[model samples]
Target: MEQISTDVAIIGAGPAGMFAVFECGMLKMSCVLIDALDELGGQCVALYPEKPIYDIPAHPAIEGAALIAQLEQQIAPFGCVKLLGRQVTGLAGEAGNFTLTTSMGDKISAKAVVLAAGAGAFGPNRPPLDGLSAYEASGAVRYYVKRREDLRGKRVVIAGGGDSAVDWALALQGVAAHIAVVHRRPKFRAAPESTAQLDALAAEGKVEMVIPYQLHALHGQDGVLQAVEVVDLDGAPRKLETDVLLPFFGLATELGPIAEWGLDLAQHHVTVTPATMETSISGIFAVGDIASYPGKLKLILQGFAEAAMAAHAIYGLVNPGMALHFEHSTTKGVPG
Candidate 1:
């Protein structure tokens, strides 16, 4: 419906996107950051925000939401040129003039494009219990629990055995009325510490651990989830009363359009130069979870480093013959 133009087009608004935005502004390049969330913060908001992240450079440990909020504040002075709550369905052209099409029927042009889409958009693979769809569409069923304070006194049934399930269980321990985790298998993919804690919860009877089972269906009355059908280990069915059915079956995020762009991906992530964070495509670069380089580390701190290099490289492309001085002297990426 409308056309916008800028120096760089950022498709996702996560950690790397935040870093890249500031970097672009420092280089005097205008940017248009498009994402599905109205407020910034990407996966931090999409996933668990209260979870402490230790690997991010200086501070040692900060909650995911806190980090995102801080990043938003840091980029506030830049004044985002354009932030649209829409998906970039398509991309055409290359450096110095890449085009992005939105789901809302809008077109934006940019000098270069950055694919900082981390893990992409993800949700649960299966609904928590049977018939929970009633509350799902009406603003009930959620995959990732971002707001810890909201779950106070609420009964939540989480499904899955991954880090997400384990993390949320711990995060919501005191906040929720009753917490239950049901996975298809007893073995979990979460860290040993997390699993051990869950085991403790199970022993304490604070958490109901349902192993080798799944939520069969949800039963609701008057447009609210009332009961859930759970199949137990011995192929038996049981019903539990639930106000909310939360399926924490990890994120099923798909790279989709980005993958179709053919930017070269190894293990479902964009491949880039470790030092430069530049991808196979000249003007298109990647800097976060969605990107990987020779010795690329997927941590947020590492993403920050990659973002810096990508910014410098982008500046070099925009302004030719400009003496680019890299701040970080140690450079050891897949060289050009």
Candidate 2:
């Protein structure tokens, strides 16, 4: 078993977790970050790299990938140990001394732990259809868009009514030879601006809106999609011929082994003290969407604030009885 030690161990590489690294580093604390994804940015990169985000403090608008890149740059000075593509299998010990085991048979010993995993481990909610696995193996169906070029010049059918579905429908307009959007309702769950763009594209006859219908079946040869069978509210079937199908039914979240860590859980989220972002177990903190408290806003900015609190609190555990001389980044500058 591989063993490592740090002042703090953060269990996510999302915006909040990355910011935690910066915060801890600012206080002269060393940290190690672990994430299940091969890369950082968590859901931002995995779910919607091209998705635009507003309401971030400084920037009025920023794409998901851009925001992640910026966060990565912000934390680069910290030089925290990054253990990517690993899941925490077991957590042992207590405050001031914790042992975390990963699926890769690696062990991390840290003075404090921070749970910044956003929505925990998430996977796309696969649409229910017979032979769906077979079609998926053939590459005709996908849960998310990894490459825009793959959809270029292809007949694509986007399924679902959420932001991801409509956003991709608008994004793929010029790239796809023909596009169709299938949803159970005409109403979209996407942002108004994105929905408007999709609406405009449909009005321009660039894309087809197959509304009030649910995916009934998929017909294809060896994973090459020929047509998609959908059922309308009236139970009438319609066949849409397409080469590819993109389903954006959202994600199914699971905390997995973390749920068994004996922390106070509210639904799928771990409950933390709003004052210090600490969990029931001392030295173990929770932040981001996976962390919850009264009046907790599930925003990136909120998580950022929580990370700061968790980092400061963790500083105490890492260096017992040591008074922290707080200094602004402008005054001290980021330590090299």
Candidate 3:
């Protein structure tokens, strides 16, 4: 097995994990980032890379792929080590000295560990319907719309009441020839503004609102979708003719091996101290969506703040006798 050593071992190369590298580098600490995915960005790059994100602080709106591109540029100067396409299957040892074993039969030794794994090991929640796999294989049913251009001039049926459903409905309005939104209830679980926009589009005859209905069956042959069958409270069937069906039912996520690390767990997340972002086990910290605390917000911005806190706390463990004189970014410029 190949052996590696670092000051901090960051498990997950998402936005938070990438930023953790910068934060640790600024404090003169070397880091090694490990992730199951082959690429840098976690969900952003894998799922919905073209989707627009409106709440990223400075930029009014940015796509998932673009946000990751900017993050890659921001952390380029640090030149941190990356162990992609590998999953950390085992963790052992104590604070200031820990070893992590990966799926690729590699061992990594680090002084501290940071868990920035956003909803570790996630996949879409597909609806339970017969012949679904055929459609999925034929590109008729998809959980994510990687590109809108693929749906151009095609009839699309979007099912769900969440943000993803509403957002995609609005995004593909002009692109798709016909758009129908199917939901079990009239009320949407998405943002009020977005729901209102969807309502406006419905009123304008640009969208069809199939409310109080749930997907019941799929009508197709040989992996080609002919129409979607839905039902209401009374079991009355309604068929929606469409070329494609997008079910934005959200993702099914698991903590995976991180759950067995002996850290305190709440639900599926690691319980951590908000002050330092450290887990119940010393020297092993948790951040991003995997860390749980009082009033925790699952936002990328919040994850960035938590990464900074974890790095500051790890500094103490890496340099036991030394003090971290806090200096603003303006005071100390980044490495060239």
lDDT of each: 0.79, 0.90, 0.94
What are the clash counts of all predictions, listed in order? 4, 0, 0
* TM-score of each prediction: 0.86, 0.94, 0.98
Badly placed stretches (over 4 Å) of model 2 are: none
Write model 2 residue lDDT over 1-336, tens digit each, in one string. 468999999999999999999999999899999999999999889877876788798989897889999989988988899999999899999898899999899999999999999988999899889889888987799987766887889999999998889888887878999999999988999889889988888899998999889999999877778999999999999999999889999999999899999999999899998989999989999999999899999899999999999988888798999998888889899998
Residue 165 local lDDT, model 3:
97
TM-score of 3: 0.98
Best by TM-score: 3
Candidate 1 least-lDDT 10 residues: 327-336
Q: After superposition, how far is residue 267 of candidate 1 from its true place, in Å?
A: 4.3
Model 2 residue 37 CA deviation (Å) reads: 1.8
Model 1: residue 289 alpha-carbon error in angstroms: 1.6
How are the candidates ranked when ordered by TM-score, highest leading? Answer: 3, 2, 1
lDDT order, best first, reads: 3, 2, 1
Write candidate 1's Cα lDDT for 1-336 as tens digits.
668987788878988898888877766677888887776778776676878887777878899889989888777767776565788899998777788898889899888888888877776686544445657775456766667787788878887778888888888888899988889898999989989999999899999987778778777775577666789878798877766667766567788778888788888888887767778988999888998766766688877777777888888767767886544324532122
lDDT of 3 by residue, 235-331 (tens): 9999999999999999999989888878899988999999999999999998899999999999988999999999999999999999899899998
Backbone clash total for model 2 is: 0
